[model samples]
Target: MARARSEERRAEILRAALEVIAERGYRGASLASVAERVGLTQQGLLHHFPTKEALLIAVLEERDQWDTGGAGLSREAWRLDLLEPLVEYNAMRPGIVQTFSALLGESVSDGHPAKDFFTERYATVRGGMGAALRAEFGNRLPGGLTPEQAAPLLVAVMDGLQYQWLLDPESVDMPGAFRDFLGLLRGAGDGPRG
Candidate 1:
């Protein structure tokens, strides 16, 4: 019972942290703000997460778990077809997406705690995406580029679409745009090469 209660409290804190991070980018969010949201004092919050960096990492991991349907970030979990549903799912969760975007933007700064995590994550994602593309399209895509070459562009489009959608949800149809991108992938090679 005690352990369950502790786990519940930790989850509450993580949710609060996400809200705070979404409202204020990771660089702007403070531990006190997150603790207050969860009805805990800073000291109490430290019992679960010793440092702001630790809390940030936990929040990121929790978000990944949710995205992966609690399967975590397995390479096998990502596929070309699965990406559309993921984007659609993201469209329904603005707050989570906002929080992720905020952290990602701030993570590029020197000495940022999340820089390594994002760097490593991108490498993994690129590899997974390349594998997925290979599985679906064989050696080269319609655009005459290998999966290795196209993987980064695919990641960019997905992330860039999120930023645009977050900035102007009324105007930006993220999932639709992503589907269009996939269509481009299929049809791009059909046209004559320059």
Candidate 2:
């Protein structure tokens, strides 16, 4: 029972931290603010997460878990066709997407605590994308690019689409745009319809 309460408190802290991070990018967010949101002192928060970085890592992992349906994804679970639905799902959760985008943008600058994490994450994602593309399209896609060449493009488009959608939700039909992109990957003429 005590362990359940501890876990519940930790979950509460993470939820509070997510809101803080969404409103204020990782670098702009502070332990004090997150602690206050959870009705704890900074020192008390430290008892759950020894450092701000630890909390950030926990938050990121939790976000991924949510994205992957909490099943703890394996590489084989990734598929090119699944991206459209993922983008659509993301559209429903602006706060989580905003936090991830803010952190990703901030992490590009040097010395950010999340820099290393984002770097590693991109590498892993790119590799997985490459594998998924190869599995679906063989060594090369219909567009004449090798799966290796296309993986980064795929990652870039998805992330880029998220940025555009976040910036102008009214003008950007993100999932549709992504489906159009997939059409381009397959071949033209089947361009984005509506």
Candidate 3:
């Protein structure tokens, strides 16, 4: 069970790192802070992660794995129905959402470690979204815009809603707002039906 214990410790470190990153953003979070959270010395933490960048990458990948339901990632188009549930799921995990938002905001600058990761991730996410839109609406999604055009908007809405919800959770109904956006995606004047 040595391997099992090692894996558990690593997961604990990642959770601690997420909390630190959520509080301090990627640039400000230090390995010592994460190590202390996991009851380890800084050198001990280094033994596991080697470097802060490696730990950050692990945290990001873990977040993605959680988002994708641990099925690894599916390149195929996501079903339109899954979007709302995903948003609702996100609402239940405020820490993860905050960490993601914090990293995304910080990654906009030049040469950030996460800059390339987010850039590549968005391209893949956009492609999946475009495929989903095309599968649902064929060449053009009711508004005369192609799926390629709408895909980025879809990503924007999801991330934008997260930012709004993070700022004022009491005011932003993230899942509901996302459902409304999906309606807009489907067609104008096609608001959610009872």
Candidate 4:
């Protein structure tokens, strides 16, 4: 029972931290602010997460869990076709998307705690995307590019669409745009080009 209570409180603190990070970015967010949101003192918060870096890692892991449907990490989890649905899902949860984008933007700075996480994550994601493309289109895609060659563009389009959608949801239909991109991928062989 005590363990359950502790787990519940930890979840609350993570949610609070997510919110604070979403609004302020990780660089601007403070441990005290996160603790205040969950009605705990800073010292009490440290009892759950020993350091701000620890809490940040937990928050990022939790976000990944949410994205992966709580199944933990699996190589087969992400595919080209599933990306549109993921974008649509992201559209419904602007706060989570905002938090992710904020962290991603801040992570490029030197010595950011999330820099290593994001770096490793992108490598994994790019490899996964390349495998997905190979599975769907064999070694080469319709545009005559190998899966390895095209994987980064796929990642870029997905993340780039998120940023555009976040900045102007009214103007950017992220899911729709992603679907259109998929269409382009599929029809790349049929079009004339320079």
Best candidate (score: lDDT): 1
Model 1, which residues run further than 4 Å from truth? 1-9, 18-30, 51-53, 188-194
**Poorest 10 consecutive residues by lDDT, candidate 1:** 185-194
TM-score of 4: 0.80
Assess each prediction's global lDDT (C-alpha) against the native.
0.84, 0.83, 0.84, 0.82
TM-score of each: 0.81, 0.82, 0.81, 0.80
Clashes (candidate 1): 1
Could you arrange the candidates by lDDT from highest to lowest?
1, 3, 2, 4
Regions more than 4 Å wrong, model 4:
1-8, 18-30, 50-54, 188-194
lDDT of predicted model 4:
0.82
lDDT of 3 at 40: 96
What are the per-residue Cα lDDT tens digits for candidate 2 across 1-194? 99999999999999998888768765656889999998999999999998776787788878777776774345665788777888888888776677678778878898988889888888878888889899999988998899899989988998999899989999998888888888878766474375
Between candidates 1 and 2, the one scoring higher on lDDT is 1
- Of 3 and 4, the candidate ranking higher by lDDT: 3
Please, what are the lDDT tens digits per residue for candidate 3 over residues 1-194? Answer: 99999999999999899888767765666898999999899999998998786787788788777777774345573666788888999898776677678778878999888788889889888888888889989999987789999989999999999999989999988988888888787787655545
